[model samples]
Target: MTPLAISANGPRESYGDKLVLDGLGLEVAEGTVFALLGPNGAGKTTAVQILSTLIRADAGEMRVAGHDLAREPDSARHAIGVTGQFSAVDGLLSGRENLHLMADLRHLGRAEGRRRTTELLEQFDLADAAEKMASTCSGGMRRRLDLAMTLVGDPRVIFLDEPTTGLDPRSHRTMWEIIRRLVADHGVTIFLTTQYLEEADQLADRIAVLDHGRLVAEGTAEELKRLIPGGHVRLGFADADTFEVAVRALSRTLDDMPRDDDALTLQVPSDGRVRSLRALLDLLDAESIEAGEPSVLTPDLDNVFLALTGQPRTAVDPPADHPVDPLTEKAVAR
Candidate 1:
């Protein structure tokens, strides 16, 4: 088993009268992506701030990259890197210059800084835009450069807050690929917070859903999907007669069997388990009913999110034009 790169317990934070986090705990294994998901104002950013040592938690015990976040903040800072929702690139500087500045901040010596900067530019596919001013770079290029800057210190753990927000599909996929390579090639542990369910589904080794400053659910994508109701088996029939007969037979044994006359299909609520499927098949065999084909439709993350959060997937977005406060941004800088 991989060692844990991040271990936190009983984290609590409040912003004046509003409570942001309520004793939430988390664990992330090394060399894996741990995605934290939440709707708008669910304390996702607050958690990131606490973990990255950007803000001190009112109460919590946290160890990031094996350094105590509260006791040895400097050590923790040295071991981690953070990229917030906003771009950290210097718009006035060229891409190469921005990277060099980060390297200088980390005191990576002039010779080593140049070598590392060259390597990262090539790795992130920014060679062509190396000399281009950051303000003129495309959204994707800027994101890549932002991440490249985060890597300048060679930190073992990285926090990416809404890394792919507002990106087009192609750019989003490009960022996903880069994130995967970061873990696979460099063994970096990533803590990601994103509203995009598909991004979490594709990149996270495990996911946790936060609501109102608490962890409502946590598991791998498949495990989380299983928590939601609505999985079922769809049985297709060869003809109308067979469909009606099967429906009649199934109606006696099943509750709320949904039938589609036009399509000659019956939808039976199921857990999509093999044992249940075998039992269903056996029951149909006893009734002498023939179903042309059967397909299992399992619940997805969207369904899980809705069932657990009591809101549609679309509601997960933060309020329009909601800006990150300066305090939050300063915490990200640390």
Candidate 2:
């Protein structure tokens, strides 16, 4: 079985009397993406820092890349790479030069350094722009180069803190594909912290939501989404005649059906499962009531976030001026 790349239990951090991460727990298995999601001041950054060996946790047992963090920080550091929210590429250096610098820092020999640099450039699709200065690169290109540099050490695990922040939709999707390939091609586990719920829903194998420095929920994206109610199946009919027949057929199949004649759609509560759907189709078939189309609508991460946090997701903008806990700020600053 693949081993765990990162794990933590009841991690705690504080600055004087103010607690930042209180009993925070997380885990990431090898070659899987575990996304940490939360509003600002939720201690997401502190968790990343502790797991990545940039800072120590006050109270908790944790391991990274199979190395006990408190007992062997250096070993953990060697096993993982980090790409913070901010770009690390120096604007003055060309993309190739930036990668070469990372190779040197990793202590690769000159010949190996150049070879690694060349490989990373091609891997990240930066070869065409390798000679361009970092300042001349677009936001997406710069982020890609930063990630390429992080892989120079061939770390088995990587920590990405809001890797796609402030990018266009196309750029964001580009990063998502790269992230997916990292785990698929290299078997590298990724510990991600991001405010983008859709990104977590799209890429993470499992997700943990943090609030007020504590984990409020954790599960697969679909599992978390299922916690919120209001999911249903929508059956569309070509005409009102067909809709009426469907309504009668569905009424016998399930309870509490809401139908709209104007739209010619019937909304029925469902978990969107194949068995339930099979039953619905059978009912329609028996009644000879045809549905033009059938689709399932399930709750999304945003709904789950709102329900769990008891606050709107929009309220926790990352740029808000609210004071962050000192411990969290200090920890992420590293």
Give the lDDT of residue 273 in candidate 1.
82
Stretches off by above 4 angstroms in model 1 are 282-290, 311-334
Off by over 4 Å in 2: 238-242, 252-255, 286-288, 312-334
Best by lDDT: 1
Displacement of the residue 140 alpha carbon in candidate 2, Å: 1.4
lDDT of 1 by residue, 1-334 (tens): 8899999899888766567789999899999999998888788888888898877888889999898987898999999999889898999999999999999999999999999999999999998679989999999999999999999999999999999998889999999999999999999999999989989999999999998888999999988987878888999989888888888888887888888899988889988888888988998899898886689888988888777777523332233224445555322211
> Residue-pair clashes per candidate, as listed?
0, 0
lDDT of 2 by residue, 1-334 (tens): 7677888999898755667788987777789999998887677776777778776788899998889988998888898899988888999999999988999899999999999999998899997669989999999999999999999999999999999999999999999999999999989999999999999999999999998778999999988977878889898889888888777767775788888889999888877668877877888898888786688999989888888876523322232222444654333211
